[model samples]
Target: MTWHVFIKELKDSIRDRKTIFLSVLLPILFNVGLLFFLENVMMNEKVEQVTVAVDSNTDPVVISWLQELKELEVELVEDPVKVVKDGDALVAFIADADFITKLEKNEIPSISVFADPTSTKGGTTQDLISNVLTIKKQEYIAQRLADNNIDPLTIEPFQINIESISEGDDMSLYMISIFAQLIIVLAVLMGGLPAANDLFAGEKERKTMEALLMTPVNRFHIIVGKWMTISALSMLSGIFSCITFIIGVNLFTERLADALQLDKNIGFFTVSLLVGIIFFALLISSIQMIISLLANNLKEAQNYISPITTLAMVPYFVLIGVSVTELNSTHFMIPFLNIYALIKQLIYGIYDVTSILLVVGSSVVFIIITFVIAYAMFMKSKWVLGKS
Candidate 1:
């Protein structure tokens, strides 16, 4: 019976230590342990003070004010522009001789902030210096007004209040997007590989293929049963990885919940997510099985599958290279890349029917092609009996 074959294959796969570790343990290690370690290190480390380069023409009082601020460190350099250009300083201040006198005169003076536009460090340093200068100017105005026997509030006629309408941090979508991609690649590949090799090459190598061929059951039933078994394992691996990521986020990143939108959405995955995940898992499993069936032995199968396994991670690289907004119709045709884009958009709470239909339809077409190819290869007596 097809059910019996499915059950037998599933049990055999479940008993393998390699399947257990690859499907379950490795995903946890990849998603939870690795992400936590990297993020924690970045978040907890002490930030170094911003080093600002300034020339002698800069006002001593302004320099003193900068040095007194805990966020900054003032470094005097002969040529501040050259220092900034050399990357020794994040920002450089070029001022004329009468910098303080101009401020006292309540006259605005030109002071250049030299920074590398391409560098985040340079931009951050420039912003901090600008903020400090702005506050200091306001203080100077207040003092001048008091000395002139006028009210400081005269200049500040009205105040504007800012109201924000958007919800939790945007990085939430980016984070969850990355997590889903890893789950698909790691889980589907890891869980399906051993089953694929063992079911095909291992059975052939052990001389069991001949006996299975003599059975009354149709070959279609056998292949379907085996495919189902492999697909089940693949689905489980992806689910386990997803669950591990969720738990890890809760335990390790509770502080980031507000910013990650976890506090609002709380439950990230829905029914559609599971359906999409399972659909991709089945697709990936079939590809693995096809590769496994091509080789004469387990070792050969592994050698062939290794490169594909590496290539299966193309989605992650694709995500890094392209922004979600830039993705178009053709991009949805790339095997794992489409799934990656879909999963990311799904996490961001996007549910456009066109994207869903594109991936689903493409998957159906590819699966049919691979299945027909695999079935044809499998039906050959020499190939099935390991004579080829």
Candidate 2:
């Protein structure tokens, strides 16, 4: 391909407002906007007040336990059951007057926690009460163990230490995976349309494609030049998107680190992230070019390429559905699936060279197929000349 022709195409692309918007401005705005909204949501705790009704016979220990959580507003009242049933309280605790007597007799005292599970605050209040009750029960167990001259640790016999084997095991990585998936979907949706429109229908509409085909340059060279330009533009958008995302992540680093339960060095994932972005961009761009080349007009091209964009997004939902599923070579060879899986692994700091190789290999193969098809379309007299 002539450098002059490539430069001309690049300049033309730079002048296209739609190209600039898709390739740079839109990705940046989307990343920043999404992060800002999520940060605000994460920082704000929505709990207003928790109302808990207590029966007349409720134990002092239970009442005190409920009252101790200053963040929660607990109200003690007669007829706790009635209050809960009437929707006057978010939760109700009913303790029998004989609870202490039953405990002394070594009988499990049954206490019913009543709450409307469907109510807004009911679930939260119920969970809070359950946690408090569990602690009280554990305390009672420890006391019982002490009374019997037994150590609680000996009775438990074994201590289990749960350790996460995944690298970057934090909330940030999880959130990043979600953001990455969204970026892929957005890149395809926004970039696919214009790339298809410009290469296929736009050329037809402009009537310049016919004259260009009359030149002595080989069809393969012409297609390669155009493909490189479109791919570069798409890749530019993808890179910008990743940069914006990293910036947003850095902005909320303190809060996100806490929320994600991450160490200070989560930013190290940036390298692998950019690698994934470039790979994904190339794959989607090639697919868009092929789809666009198949269309007869802008409207027809959009109709054809729209489904491809949706197809590109299918793996995102599929990956979410099967996130816990084991990874294998079969899974690694699939196009979008490999990217999503590798991204998850990358975020978690699990680097499997074999999987990466497979993904890269599959991508290269697909890229080759796309170029071959694109060249065939470029060589077709009617299609290249816009006579059909």
Candidate 3:
């Protein structure tokens, strides 16, 4: 009987274009659009040129070198410091009046840089100038060493050589892991929403609740059937969204794909991630169903239920700054945060069986507790009919 109810509800949900669009198609489009926008617009854009004010008294050779660099545009000014303070340039360069004489005498000369420390452009300009000066200093040292008949290599100590055995780009894995986990969690809430709202609240608003109750089916069986339907749709939404996101990443962004790590442990990570999503799906489904059952009508249900997606995201934001290494087995016992922690583990290819087990065990306990509350609510005639 529960199977029959499940099949009927599933068919009805599949037939609703709105439901299908909300649950599956929207997530696919969102993932693809997000990847396209990030790849072409956000990530690929480059900083072209930074302007700086240089004092007229500065050395002509230094001024010419700065002007020759493709990334800098130098402006000669009498008061470089005043130009920078007045926001005329991103940075300013000034040197002591006898700077050239000091260099000829092999004596160190003072230099001053001025810029707004809080400005991003100023910071970038400062970094560029600093790098150029560093290279010039090294050249000056080499010339002095040659003049004294000393080998440049004699000044350097032993160098350290580093070799990495890791497979993927750390930056790419970090970005993909965050994007994938967020999409999956949001998909679960969205996918189950339409069915949960329509199953109970829509029926009440349409005056069909009485007909459903008149059937000889057990109330507990009805709740189970409806819960299973929501869970199945939620799982479908999450799985399809994840698939579309991966494919979108592969097809639209070759830069990320080339750096992606594909190894033996990928199988374990994928399976564990899927299992974690499934457990979360079941938990979210029961909770949504309970919210739906309590609402007087579809509008009230929507008003009450829509905030859940935003509420679900709070944990993601909280855990964003925390590193995976800082988390212990106790962290996996948490609800929304455990999924994030699991993704962090996958990012670094760390498979902690204890954390995985705790996630599964805690999820099961929450699922049972929520389903029991939903069952209790369903058994009450007043809640079932939304009267009191």
Per residue, candidate 3 scores C-alpha lDDT tens digits across 12-90 of 8989998899788989999998788666765564757877899998988777768867878889899988888888888
Cα lDDT, all candidates: 0.76, 0.71, 0.82
| lDDT tens digits, residue span 217-237, model 2 | 776777667766776777777
Q: Using Cα atoms with residue i matched to residue i, what is each candidate's TM-score against the true structure?
A: 0.71, 0.74, 0.79
Model 2 residue 67 CA deviation (Å) reads 3.3
Q: What's the lDDT of the predicted structure labeled candidate 3? A: 0.82
Worst lDDT 10-window in candidate 1: 254-263
After superposition on all CA atoms, how large is the RMSD of candidate 2?
4.8
- List where candidate 2 sits over 4 angstroms from the true fold: 1-5, 37-40, 43-60, 75-109, 113-125, 144-160, 166-169, 205-218, 255-275, 318-332, 350-356, 381-388
Best by lDDT: 3
Give the per-residue Cα lDDT of candidate 3 at 234: 93
lDDT for 304 in candidate 1 is 91
Clashing pairs in 2: 171-260
